[model samples]
Target: MKLVSFRASGADRLGIVFPENKVADAQQWGAANGMDVPDSMLGLIDKGLEFRDSMSAKVKATAVDDNADYVYDYEAVKILAPMPKPARNIWGIGLNYTEHVAESARSLDTDNKLPQECIIFSKPTNTVIATGEAIKHNGNQTQQMDWEGELAVILGKGGFRVKAEDAMDLVYGYSIINDISARDNRRQGQWIVSKGMDTYAPMGPVLITPDEIEDPHNLQIITKVNGVEKQNGNTKNMLFRIPEIIQDISSVMSVDPADIIATGTPAGVGAGRDPQEWMWPGDEVEIIIEGIGSLKNPIVDDTY
Candidate 1:
């Protein structure tokens, strides 16, 4: 089932997309009537993996039920990040692609080159933005801004010291993550602050179940700025796969359900070009991954 978090009335709610992409409110329907699981995607995962599976099945089955309580057209509502406020830190891998690594070498001082081991960073919870939201393009603080299109993994079960072989079992589903970056701030210091800017992490349209994607790492990740194609690559070039990343991180800390893992962006970023170009105000950025829907946002003049 393809799930989404959307705004209805004045609040955010959980929903499932039906045959034609119609929205079905999982929570409101459960409250007014009854449900097998909680409304929020995070809540359903907290209930355990079995609960997620059962609820997903029920959501699919309810599509044909004449008494279905709540159903709305796809365009009738605003799409929010599948998990508005995830419980754990958002972990992101950097320089996992050879070309991206090579670009970093050219842009950074010798001392700032890629580490021998996996290079990991974190994005705060507040950085998470819903699909169709505006990304600030102000030039006051940062002179250069860029985009990275990557496949993001959302965890379903909590686990620490997980084996690489068993890592896939903890995943809830997949979503496209636009790792918006501030090139200036990033080159100045670490990514926690630069890449963690408000609305820097725009994710979603829908969270597709793993069953829908036979091979998560086999999809294409493409990005465009103002209708001009800028980045085109596939997950096949990843140096560290999903299972290896999970194992690498889990060995140190527990990965809670809903904690996002931005597997790493593919090559072809703006910084990788001979003459670097960055996003400016009035520019539109669109990120699309196979099987998952596209995430589009306009870059506005950010006063902040």
Candidate 2:
């Protein structure tokens, strides 16, 4: 099921997106149909599987019923991040792809050596944004704005010292994130400052539940800028997959429900290119993941 957080009629509500672009408003439908449901994506995630399974069944049944009253126009509702307000910082793994590592090395004139383990980073919760939201172009602060399209994981259960083999059991679903970065900050080794700008992390048009995606590893991830394809890669290229990522992080910090893990990006980021193409006002950045969906955001100058 493709779960979503959306605002309709000025109120935020949880939605289940069915094929054909139809969305069922959980809060409204549950109220009208006498079925209780969570009003937010975070609420749903915390409610556990029984609740989600029941809600999914309700969403599916009510979607196909011509007499159902809660189906709304997908285009009319404004989409938000899977968890519009994250409970904590979004965890990220850096240099987890070989090609990306090589490109990054070449760009920074560093050794073209891949990390033996995942390089982790974090994005402030405030950085999160949704599809169609404008990526704040900090034209004044820094001119080297870049985009890193990555596959993000949402955890269902909180855990510490989790095992790699058991990682999938704790995962809730998956979404797309544009890990926008300021290359200048990165050049100075200020990762958080470079990648944590508010609205820089453009994510979600749809959040597909784990059941819908049979295999996350084989999915194709593509990023395009203003209609020109820039990054093209498959998740299979990831040097550190989901299992290892979960094990690596959970060993140090407790992973919580609604926590977002951005499994490193692939090659072809602007900073890694020959001419180092950067995003400017009026440019559109789009990240397309195989099973999930497209997250497209326009760049708007947020300069003083």
Candidate 3:
């Protein structure tokens, strides 16, 4: 199921993506049907299977219940990040892809040995940016900004010390994130300053449930800047897949419902380029993960 959070007429709305790119307005549909479905994505994440089943049934019923009038043209509203602001920092892993590790090492003129374990990082809540928003260039703070297209996993159920085998139970769904990084500020091995800037993570168009994805680790992920394909790789190639990542993260901290996990990127980031490239004003960046949908955002100076 493809679920979304949209903003229109000065209010936030919950929706389900239906056939032919149509969006069924969950909030309005519930009110009309005398049902009290969760109106927020966070509520849906915590509502669990019963809510999902109910919503799915209602969405199907709307097709024939001509009076429902909940389905809307997908373009009528502005898409917000499925989970606009995660409860906490978004968990991130670096060097999880061999090619990325190689490219990064080459760019930094360092050793190419693989990270011994899951190298995790955190993207504070402020980094979250919706698909249609602008990725701030922050030209005043840093002159160069780069992008990392990644598959983001959202947790529906909170868990701690979770086992690798059972981690799937904690999954809510998946979205795409552009782990936009500021190469200049990523100094002295500390990425917090470089990665924590506002609008660093451009996420979503919608979130797709596990049932919609046959194999979470086999999707084709691609990133294009201004219509030119840049990063292209398959999720199956990640060194530490979803299971391992969940297990590793949950062991250290309690991952709450609605938390996000940005599962690293494949190679071909701007920083890895021979001469390096930085996103500038008006550059459109599109991160497309097969099945989840594309998240496209434009680059703009911090001023506006």
Candidate 2 C-alpha lDDT tens digits along 224-289:
999999999999999999999999999998898888999989999998999889999999999999
Error of 3 at 78 (Å): 1.3
Index of the highest-lDDT prediction = 2
Query: Considering only N, C-alpha and C atoms within 3 Å, which residue pairs clash in candidate 3?
Result: none
Evaluate model 2: give its TM-score: 0.95
lDDT of 1 by residue, 1-304 (tens): 7889988777677887878767878776555446654768788777777766776676656644334547777788889988888776689998888778887778743234555666789988877888888888767767778899989999988799999999999999999988988878864567776788888888887899888888987899999998898888889888889999999899898888888999998777887777888888888899999899899988889866
Alpha-carbon error at 218 in model 2, in Å?
A: 0.7
Model 3's lDDT to the true fold? Answer: 0.86
A best-first ranking of the candidates according to their lDDT comes to 2, 3, 1
Per-residue lDDT tens digits for candidate 3, residues 117-204, read 7999998999998988998887777877888999999988888999999998888889999998888887788889888999999999
Winner by lDDT between candidate 3 and candidate 2: 2
- Winning model by TM-score: 2
- Can you list the residue pairs that collide in candidate 1? none
lDDT on C-alpha atoms for all candidate structures: 0.82, 0.86, 0.86
Give stretches of model 2 more than 4 Å off. 31-35, 57-62, 109-111
User: Between which residue pairs do clashes occur in model 2?
Assistant: none
Ranking according to TM-score, highest score first: 2, 3, 1
